[model samples]
Target chain A: MTDKPATPRRRGAARTEELLQVTLDLAVEVGYAGLSIEAVARRAGVGKHTIYRRWSSMAELLLDALSRAWTSDLDYRDTGDVRADLREQFLRSAPALSSPPIGPVYRAVIAEAQSDAALRATLHERFLVTVEQRTLERITLAQSTGELVDGVDLEFAAEVLCGTLYYRALLTDRPIDEAAVDGLLEMFMAAYGAAG
Target chain B: MTDKPATPRRRGAARTEELLQVTLDLAVEVGYAGLSIEAVARRAGVGKHTIYRRWSSMAELLLDALSRAWTSDLDYRDTGDVRADLREQFLRSAPALSSPPIGPVYRAVIAEAQSDAALRATLHERFLVTVEQRTLERITLAQSTGELVDGVDLEFAAEVLCGTLYYRALLTDRPIDEAAVDGLLEMFMAAYGAAG
Candidate 1:
């Protein structure tokens, strides 16, 4: 009649997710350097052991939080319009990278990674490289369907587009707003998009 | 004829140049946050007053060092070869932003500027915006002379090219080396190069 007991795996996963959210939140409040394991545990109402058991160091915890924060699992439309699809894809990730909570946490992590090699490796592998791969795949798909031009340099186009947005997100006061996105989309489209 | 007595203005200018070189060296040795006016004065064999007189704070000192470090008053060739000129322009700045002393100093300032607002604004104004303006001017010149195609987004092209390099310099282990520069030059040329 009643609900079944939760599995150990489910309990462990739920706790981990809760801890990640806590870390991400703390990243905003205290930033990267001040975000200690002890502080995260206190904020999450979990024992220190709960977090340490999952992450051996604050660096590892920061990387996990960053992976989640920068993740962009976009549901891009095939409106047969490369420009619109590109805009949609960019907007999907821009909010995660520019809005509060996640954005500040990401900025703190990026700033920290400048001096931390192991952390930079994790960021390069998990976020920068991963995002580039996903974007390249989308560009390749666009090419196959004739949305993008044939024989275009896939890596160059993808990196430049994403790099532009990351430029603004990390360094500039200008957010990649709708207008900026449109400009980016148009620039990229002129470079790679198929003609009408 | 006896040499004219060294005017105070000439003596002060020489001392300022020596101080800037000292600070740039300290940036390589101790990094941005660790650099101090005292150390710069000690290394340059000048009084701390020499540096403090020029820059009121370490942040201002850092910006001055960065501006001098990155500036390249290149006499670019209009050799009717886009790739060659592109390579030359990129290589000119790459050494400054990638080599010892200046390169490390620039990296240190960039890392320091990430969390520092006043420093960031100084960097954004003195180096980033200035460099972009010069680059945009060159692109405009190319367009006018029929090197690059007409109606290409000049700002977008310039920013993407430089932004790609900045991304590597600030965030990753990969240096903006020859091959990387080649890829970038090709990308820009493909999108905007005027046909023969």
Candidate 2:
């Protein structure tokens, strides 16, 4: 292999990845309230301007870090049984949401968003909206197949599904365990399951 | 009108009320992040020790303030119709949750709880548990009256009911409006309503 200097584009991309990684590490350790660009720059051995140039605020930077690190499969696998599909998806993703790197950081952003409307909008547009829309699509498909009830407002159904898990995860000390998932599904099915 | 100095007990009680009131006012103005015992004392024209003698932490003091100002009737009005009762309660309390004083301050405290486990537990024990339990009681009564489905785990039902409203209130900008409330109740009724 020829030993040559990396291109500016390659160097910039590498730096960006490094910054994001460092941000994730710091978020898990100190949480959102303790995180700042200055701290990230110090940890990454870069100037604050480097981070500011890429992201306007700490929330934006943290959002990118979370989005990059969020590797869980968000899409549902249609197992022909809509209930089974939802159960599988939640069982897979709930742990990631309640655990490190993503969990604490995401909670911090949500907390900060209570005060910052712009961040709230960004979070909804970027993360929550995607999750909600995916849920709606899955349930809509189920409705079409006659697996779910017809002529009902499925958007509210979607919100309840996603929102309940988030509530258990973010607000309460309750576990997003199998029991919780099953209970939620039971209610959903009872409400939306088509007449046999 | 008191022509003489108030008794020590009376004065202490008055001071406590003043401190809690000041705490609520400050919480609404600056949010939990901007709040401190020092700021509350300064604003209330009292020493920090005066505020500290009664409450142990800012969160505790804030909790007291919230409890004091929380005037909404948490109990459901047994209208015999379970859906109507729930709808009435949600419509009544949702405005308090989304509006000034309570809304912003409560959001800030919830946000702070993400980082602090003690605060989280306190919030759960003090506020969420009460709401959840009351909902359980209401639904349990309905179940007994042949309104709700029997033999189902109603605790989970309670969580979903309260949790969805909270999810909408705190996480998303979606208004907890009549349609939203009605949609949620429709699902609940569909799931839990006793088979005719």
Candidate 3:
């Protein structure tokens, strides 16, 4: 009994992964809003009910795809200097949101999530909150070390930093290069920190 | 000859507006990427040739729709204070980007444009550049009169400002309220203005 159950469970998990991979492919090739479970099944050569059994709806399936797109090891290394630390973390994560598999998925969700509260909840819960918390930690460290200014709203600052990145990545075709990142940090530091 | 041409010209113009209106409606209801020329023609009750005759592609149709979504008369009143002038301009344009007819359409295009070059081009050309130019004009006015720092990169500063709004309007469902606008202006003034 245990052998039979385990083998099928493994097969199911493999199929789920395939479905997700195909979902990301379609999201990049077609678009987030343009493709559906039917389309995904058609592409992946699976029955539509396969996705429905695992995920509640198309949005949930996409959310699952997006959440898996990033490495959960997004822990920022704590350098002695706050600016360098933040920049390092940014460099690490930038590619995930800008590349084909993940970036397009993220862009699709952000585009759809704007109007759909459920999708936004999924984004905030599964993804964005972690980034926000990390930034807050960095800001707090900077404040204690006399890098950041006193009395700045740490939450708002973190939100703005993430918002600015999302603004560039999803909204504009502007290149989010090192120079642009430096400029963003400059504005952020000037507004939130005092130069030592 | 002029009179004969004018009748069909007026009819063509009216039909074009109707098509744009229908495009916006579909964009808001069905979203940007998913809806096609066939869909638009179906909703607008016209032959597919009608759309093909005027616009080469669905991207071009959505571009035409987005282009007309804004009130071209978004003139900022020349208030003596730069902050006040900028704030007033934000107030004027906030509604169009936040509500239905235009807001959803803008959101849909922004979401879809992330992966499509032609759509991004249309967006950059029609919407973003105008906002950037206006913000640059404000920043320059403030700089020449000694309100802002002398060496600030006027273009970048403008881009950041517009980026922040697009961040809020498209990425997050955060209320782009008066208080939020005030905070953005505060950051802009502090970073760019000569407060030291």
Candidate 4:
């Protein structure tokens, strides 16, 4: 009886992931505004209720799609050295950051987030807050490890660094390159190096 | 008689500037998709033919508007010093850059540029290419004055600095503060500072 129940539960979980994949593909193809669960269900060959069971609204579905699409969830290593760890983390995320699918999705969601209150709330809850908190944690770790200098305001540094990267992604038509990444890391390191 | 005639031309140009301001305000309020010449005419209380006589198309009108809105036309100054001039230039533009109206218009145009080929062409021709050219000229002035460090690539530096600022406008929820302005200036100067 236990084995029978476990097998069906495993299958249901797998089906949910499959449905999510289909939803993301639709989002990437048509954009956030164009996305509909009906289209997703049709594409996924799943039922409308199946989608509704998991996500109550389109914004929730889109947010889930976005969170799933965030491919850069690497370990935030202390490594007893801030600069080296940052460089590694940035470099590791570079390929994912530059991927074609991710770029358009990110751009669309960001634009949509500006207009949609629910999306804005979901974005803050699921992505933005987590990103800010995690980054602050890493900076704190660096401060504790003496990797960053004394009196270095971790919050400001986090904003500056992430702000620079996100700015590159949104404003300029150029692709985020290796040298630019290296330069950002070096510049921040140099600025905060004296803080410790 | 000719000198008197020139005064009317100047007055006409001033009226055209006012018309463009109305255009930008409309563009920000109703986005590019919803923006129409008829709506602009209604808002400006200018006759439709008046706008049509001056500009052939919506694209042309937008180009004229953008050109008029670019109030900062600073020529690159060579004072045999890069850091000081850069600081001055950046600080001077900070207020203009931080203006609430300009950012929303810039984003609305950018979003429109993504899917509209004609809009993209106008954006590049009227704004981006010219900005890039002028920025290069400024960086060249820095190089010539012997203030910019050797081996600092002019175009990349310009992109990094300008792109970072634009990105800040595009993404961050916070208002543009003096610290960010100073931090950006510091980053650019540090990256390009020559050993004295």
Q: Each candidate's chain B TM-score?
A: 0.78, 0.80, 0.74, 0.68
**Candidate 4, DockQ score (0 to 1):** 0.21
Give the per-residue lDDT digits (tens) of candidate 3, residues B1-196: 6556557889899999999989888887886667899999999999999999998888778867876777463556666678898888887788888677777767667666765766777777767777788778877988888888887576877777777777766645576789777878877777777775
Runs in model 3 lying further than 4 Å from the true structure: A1-73, B1-56, B72-74
Which one wins on lDDT? Answer: 2
Q: Against the unseen true structure, what C-alpha lDDT does each candidate score?
A: 0.75, 0.87, 0.76, 0.67
The alpha-carbon lDDT assigned to residue B139 of candidate 3 equals: 75
The local lDDT score (0 to 100) that residue A95 gets in candidate 2 is 84
Indicate the docking level reached by candidate 1.
acceptable
Candidate 1 lands at a TM-score of 0.84
> Which sequence of candidate numbers ranks them by lDDT, best first?
2, 3, 1, 4
**Tens digits of per-residue lDDT for model 4, A11-46:** 788988887788788877897778888999899888
TM-score of chain A of 4: 0.76
Interface RMSD of each: 2.1, 1.0, 2.1, 3.9
Off by over 4 Å in 1: A1-3, A37-57, A70-78, A88-99, A173-180, B37-56, B70-78, B95-99, B173-179
The collision pairs in model 4 are A149-A195, A149-A196, A150-A195, A150-A196, A167-B167
TM-score of each: 0.84, 0.80, 0.74, 0.65
Error of 4 at A141 (Å): 3.1
What lDDT does model 1 reach?
A: 0.75
- Residue-wise C-alpha lDDT for candidate 2, range A90-187, written one tens digit per residue: 99888887577687789889888887778887777667877888889999999999999889999989999999998888777778899999999999
The order of the candidates by TM-score, greatest first, is 1, 2, 3, 4
